[model samples]
Target chain A: MTNETGAPLLDVSGVTLRYKTPGALITATERVSFAVNRSDRFVLLGPSGCGKSTLLKAVGGYLKPSEGSITILGRKVMEPGPDRMMVFQEFDQLLPWKTVLENVMFPLLDARNLSRKEAEEKARHYIDKVSLTRALHSYPHTLSGGMKQRVAIARGMAMEPDILLMDEPFAALDALTRRTCQDELLQLWEETRFTVMFVTHSINEAIKIGNRILLLSPHPGRVKAEVVDVDTASPTDGSAGQLEKEIHDMLFSQEEAH
Target chain B: MSSKARIVMRPLEDAGSGEVERELSFLEKAWDNSGVRKVAIILALALIWELYGRWTDNALLFPPLSDTFAALIDNIRSGVLPARAWTSLKILLMGYAAGIVMAGILTIAAINTRLGSDFLETMTAMLSPLPAIALLPLALLWFGLGNGSLVFILIHSVLWPVALNTHSGFRAVSTTLRMVGRNYGLKGFAFIRKILIPAAFPSILAGLKIGWAFAWRTLVAAELVFGVSSGQGGLGWFIFENRNLLEIPSVFAGLLTVILIGLIVENLIFRTIERRTVLRWGLQS
Candidate 1:
């Protein structure tokens, strides 16, 4: 792995993650490495079983890497903290017992150790950013799938963490909602420019969401290539299709070789 | 053949003529109220009982529903039924609360460690199926002729079900929710208090209901076997005394009191708690 420019905000070097099943020791990722600079939308794009989610979890400090290390601000990642908040794919990530306002304020009031008043104000700001002011008192179960994900995103964003790790946040949403959420996410990013590490299987989403897309191979995922789309072109432009086709051809040719 | 048959499709423009919602008849509306439906069933049952009692025509045998009610009123007026009910309710509360506290301790410990988990599983397996009343004879030998023995059996009946349901509920909390909780740096007690407890509250409430039922029945049954404890007795003893004195209507009245208490506790107290918590949260419909 190459260290680009000055100090990267987050550095994951040769990280190898493994877990034990009842009968087997499974390797999820093999020496997969990348660095996410501050304000970069870094997307880990791969197919199912490619260990992108596992890698994200590793960065979030929920899972430990067996062989290598993950660091943010030169501090070794050991366990989950407010420093790296995760927006999960499932709606159950928001506590059902808590209202939307409370859910967003949870980590703010907790790990951030903010005053209740400060937390509520910050929570409200983020919730409003997600356009969920109307649902401040609603429970997760009462909200639609998209709304739940938005609350999750708001909760993660409210913490103002070093990096926000999103594990296919919009993957469970309906297509129309997914598109809308992605646009909203980009708009939010444009407004704040907070660093985010997004994991997704959708290539179109990868291109649309990431400034730097890291393609991973199928199983025991190893980084195949890091495609830097310096143009900042979205799918609305014809160049996105060109880049998509190029990435597809590269993946297809690699599969043919295998 | 393809050219001859073209597909004809029509979109649903106004599917229900803009009147999808309609008003129901008065009877239909009444049928929708569970309380009304239950009352209707009760009236039908009372009519059957009155007819059957009249056919038998033996006051010594099955007393009429009206006679039973009259007997119940008579006992209440004499302050006999109220005193007995109070006696039973006091003992029931002591036993039920103690049992709940023990269950909570056990469940919290079980979720925290392997040994505690094993202890809970083994205890529930061994004790839950063995009827609590079956322990009364042994309890009497140990505690001897007092409320102590009855409380002992009540604890036995209530502890297992509450612990079992709570353990399972905690275990059944979704992995995603657990991660979300931990991701906020909530560890150990905070994790259990904020995440696990409320997440598994539906099962906890069910366990409470089951424990209440078990403790109530065991209390009554124990009273029947050893009703005289330290010179006072409960409703079960009231029934036993009336039966011995050939007061059949009074015995029925005692039985009616038990049913009434059970109905009120279940429909009022537990129902209110459920509505305020799990039902309000939509965890249980």
Candidate 2:
């Protein structure tokens, strides 16, 4: 995929991920190719164990693919760096000891050439962006699941990474909270225009948040389908119900077939 | 309206105000009070002990709380207690500080190297069960009748618990947290500081508490066993001396001081720390 405005933010080509456990070498994903444009909300949707999260991890540079390569803004990802930050499913992703503000400020402290004051300012900006200004001094234990994820998101965004990787970050949240967070994420993206690669099993979430959704098959996940959201300019409106239902049906039938 | 219907209606009309009044009365009566029960239990235990002490009439074997407190007051007034306490505390601090520093370095080294970690695990496995008091005689032989001997035993008592706790805490930090730290480009000491240390804090705090208790107990016992007084002996030495002289109440006094100190350190210092850090954070079970 070629973009006219700017070069693609993330280009993942023929990526294959594998894991070796006690007995056998398990193939997680195969021949996966995708390009996320600058500020594109790219979503990977699949069944459990279909390597959606693995793909996200690979992009975040936590997992080196068994084969092929991933590049962010023409720079190849070799190892985990400050270029890409990830929001994880587990609320415990935030360091329990650090307050909400501290957790947000964490990435900036390690990033190059930022003083404590500067980091604090940057962290505060992102924390406010995530609407967690009220909970700044409160520890992770005091925050609810949604609040914790917001802190994680704030922390990830504070780094100003080239791409934000989310591995089912809202999967643990309740329905009402999940929708609210999804809306907030879209708002943040609209404002900041940071690239995102999101993984989720929920079709509704994929359709609602993703600019482009890529579906993967189970058992060594291969790209089954890609749906472009040209018709819906805005992701979250009451009218997207039809689109959500259609995608839901597609995923359900796909699962039934397998 | 029928008579029976009128009776039912009248009762229902009264029920609302009566229910509220009953609820208020129940609240006033303290329907679910545990404070009284707790006080009662403590008083009952004290009464039993007093009765038992009266029956035995043995001042040496089982001194009453009153007798112990009186002796404690006398010793404190005479100034033998304060001077000896200071000496013991100094030794305790020195040994405890040394042990903590050593354990921290070892843990850092261990975390970085597989071989170091394996070695630590093996050594801890071998040495954890060997009592600190049991090392007193050996410590005496090595350091020869001074604070050095007491220091050695205190170090032995402190090292294992602290090392074990720290190492395990470092190990138990979530992999996701580590990955997140690395994702932000933190490595080596930065990673351990920002990610591992905080994540493992509850465990580390537990270790510190245990190590402190061990060190405190070991220091006194070591002193008692090897009391070579250059005009100063710790609480344990004081007790031993008092016992030898057949000053039974003073012996009881020394023992009481030890208990008091332990209670103060544990409840007043360490308990507050646990409450503020681990319990407040909801990290500890």
Q: lDDT, candidate 2, residue B43?
A: 79
Give me the displacement of residue B158 in model 1, in angstroms: 0.7
- Cα lDDT for residue B84, candidate 2: 77
Clashing residue pairs in candidate 2 are none
- Which portions of model 1 show Cα errors greater than 4 Å? A1-5, B1-18
Clashes of 1: 0
| lDDT per residue (tens digit) for residues B1-285 in model 2 | 455644334446645455443345665556357756666787797687667766888987776666766788988999998877878888899999999988998899899999989988988999989999998878778987888888888888888899999999999888888888888788888888877887798889888989999998888887788774566888889888888988777887887688778888888898888787777667885
**Highest-TM-score candidate:** 1
Least accurate stretch of 10 residues (summed lDDT) in model 2 chain B? Answer: B2-11
User: Fraction of the real A/B interface contacts present in each candidate?
Assistant: 0.70, 0.74
